[model samples]
Target chain A: DAGVTQSPTHLIKTRGQQVTLRCSPKSGHDTVSWYQQALGQGPQFIFQYYEEEERQRGNFPDRFSGHQFPNYSSELNVNALLLGDSALYLCASSTELAAGELFFGEGSRLTVL
Target chain B: AQSVAQPEDQVNVAEGNPLTVKCTYSVSGNPYLFWYVQYPNRGLQFLLKYITGDNLVKGSYGFEAEFNKSQTSFHLKKPSALVSDSALYFCAVSPTLAGGNTGKLIFGQGTTLQVKP
Candidate 1:
């Protein structure tokens, strides 16, 4: 089965610009979550999407938003990007039956200039 | 509040030697601890988890973890180290705090394991 897949494996953006990253969940999975991993640090949860609605969110600002399509794919949008926003963006997928241990994608490396 | 801590930044061990990565968590109520390994430029792979069973749980790639409720620690262990096992290790906790799988995971800083051949 195909694992979780993310688009634009790497992206570059300028400060004050906006970017959108897409993710497709693993086969047979429904829930999609986004995380940010800085150099030498673990992944931090950004938010989760279930049933096409954002169910839970982390301490990110309004600049960070996400959407879950009916097909279980997800998109993470960052507006007014900051240099600190430069990190490896990860998309994880899981099921309601086992919502804890998530399957992650290769991730999108975001570089803000 | 829920948090996870990995005390070691890097762990070095010779081949065939045993290995251990330390982790501890802080959360109210029950904690669902997990161990994941991330190879360079790859996604995180699940190693093992402790839900509500015996303190010891075995997982993929000959990895295991011991959960200590009193200490609030879950340490990953391997009987023998392999050069291929070199990667970044992360520990996470799911706070079963009366929410329906909000899916917010608190992760450790990460431990780099270097298995010398």
Candidate 2:
């Protein structure tokens, strides 16, 4: 009955450094998607993982990558982070294909200082 | 490309007053619309969705959204506003699975709602 869960409620990183955020999808869910939300702005799609492979990606740079574990958990890795990388990284999970109603995690706040 | 617009950056209303947040969408086919809310420094919470069938769809937290095909709009409404209702709202749209676009959603810029006492 647990909802989506994320780790390390917050993080601080510097330029050129790498950061990895974690997420566990809601029970009975198998697909995971990542999104980035900047202050006062809406969330933007990053990428989606299904069947342990990236099914789709957004306009993000190659520096952004993700992995979906066999257990349906996900990790979002951002390499060579820039100041602009500072934002709230949210992970959403859904079970059925093309079903846009997603259950989202609390999200990890990444601060690139 | 699919897109959504929330024209009002902010909407303020007194407690107990009815509230409405405007949204408009653009898509190549039938739209699968959604409304989500975000509290201070939190992730987005699903409020409701409009996929098909009735134009009126009700969701959690006493929220309801009306899907208007002619206007290409999905506006979120609440009969009575609560002080705790203050938050940021986002409208999103995607071509429904039947309409032939992937399930990926395109979201609006977000609107800040302030329900004052």
Candidate 3:
């Protein structure tokens, strides 16, 4: 079975711009969570979506938002991107039945110049 | 607030030697700990986790982690290290709210493991 997949593997944007990254959860999974990994650091949680509604969120500001479609695919949208927003955005998928473990995608590299 | 700490920035070990990567976590109640490995230009891969069962949990590859409740630590261990084992390791904790797993992970800064041949 295909694992989690993300689109726009690499992209660049200037400050004040907005970017949207996409993800398709692994087959048989219903939850999608987004994470941001800065250079030389581990990933920080952004938010998680289940049933097309946000179930949990991290410390990120309102500028970061996400959407989950009926098919369980997700999209992460970052508005007014700052230079510090540049990082690798990872998408992970899991099921409520398997609560703790997650399967991640290759991630989309965003460079806010 | 839930958090994870991987004190070492990097660890080096010779091939065929044993290796251990240390991790400690802090959370309100029972913590769900996890270990993930990331290779260059790759996403984090789940290694193992400590939910509610055995203190010693064996996972993918040759990785095993020991959970010490008193110490609040979960250290990953391997009897023999391979050169290919070199990668960035992350320790994470899943926060529980209202007695349910939120599925949100708080990750450590990560430790780079170098297994020299």
Candidate 4:
């Protein structure tokens, strides 16, 4: 089965600009979560989407938002990007039955200039 | 708030030697602990988890973690290390909500393991 997949594997944006990263969950999975991994650090939870709505969120600001479609794909949008926004954006998928165990995609490397 | 801590930034071991990466967690209620490995340019890969079972949990790539409730620690261990095992290891914890698991994970800073042959 195909694992989690993310788009725009690598991209660059300037300050005050906006960017959107896409994710397709693993086959047969319905939940999608986004994480940010800064240099030399582990991933920080951004938010999680289930049933086409954001069910859980982390410490991120309003500038960061996400959407889950009926097909279980997800998109993470960052508005007014800052230099600190530069990091690896990882997308993970899991089912309600297997909640804690996540399958991650290679991640999209976002570089803010 | 839930959190995870990986005490070591880097660990070096001989290829044939055993290895241990320490992790400690803090949570309000029952904590669902997990271990994940990440290679260069790759996402975190699930290793093992500690749920409501035996203290010892085995996972992919011969990785095993021992959950100590009293100590609030989950340390990943391998009987023998391999050069291929060199990568970044992360410890994460999810709090158990009254309804169910929120599927949210709090991750540690990560520990780099170097297995030299």
Q: DockQ winner among the candidates?
A: 4
Quote model 1's TM-score. Answer: 0.98
Considering just the first chain, candidate 1 attains a TM-score of 0.98
For model 3, the stretches where C-alpha displacement exceeds 4 angstroms are: none
> Among the candidates, what TM-score does chain A have in each?
0.98, 0.97, 0.98, 0.98
Candidate 4: the clashing residue pairs are none
- The alpha-carbon lDDT assigned to residue B81 of candidate 2 equals 97
- The candidates, ranked best first by DockQ, are 4, 3, 1, 2
Q: What is the per-residue lDDT of model 4 for residues B1-117, given as tens digits with 9 covering 90 to 100? A: 667889999999999899999999888788789999999988899999887889999999999999999999999999999999999999999988899777899999999999999
| Rank list by lDDT | 4, 3, 1, 2
lDDT by residue (tens digit), candidate 2, A1-113: 99999998998998999999999999999989999988877788999898999988999999999999999999999999999999999999997564788888989999999
Candidate 4 error regions (>4 Å): none
Model 2 C-alpha lDDT per residue in residues B1-117, reported as the tens digit of each score: 677889999999999999999999888678788999988867789899988899999999999999999999999999999999999999988565563545567889999999999
Candidate 4 lDDT by residue in tens digits, A7-98: 99999999999999999999999999999999998899999998999989999999999999999999999999999999999999999778
Ranked by DockQ, the better of candidates 2 and 3 is 3
Model 4 residue A88 CA deviation (Å) reads 0.4
User: Model 3: per-residue lDDT, tens digit, B68-97?
Assistant: 999999999999999999999999999777
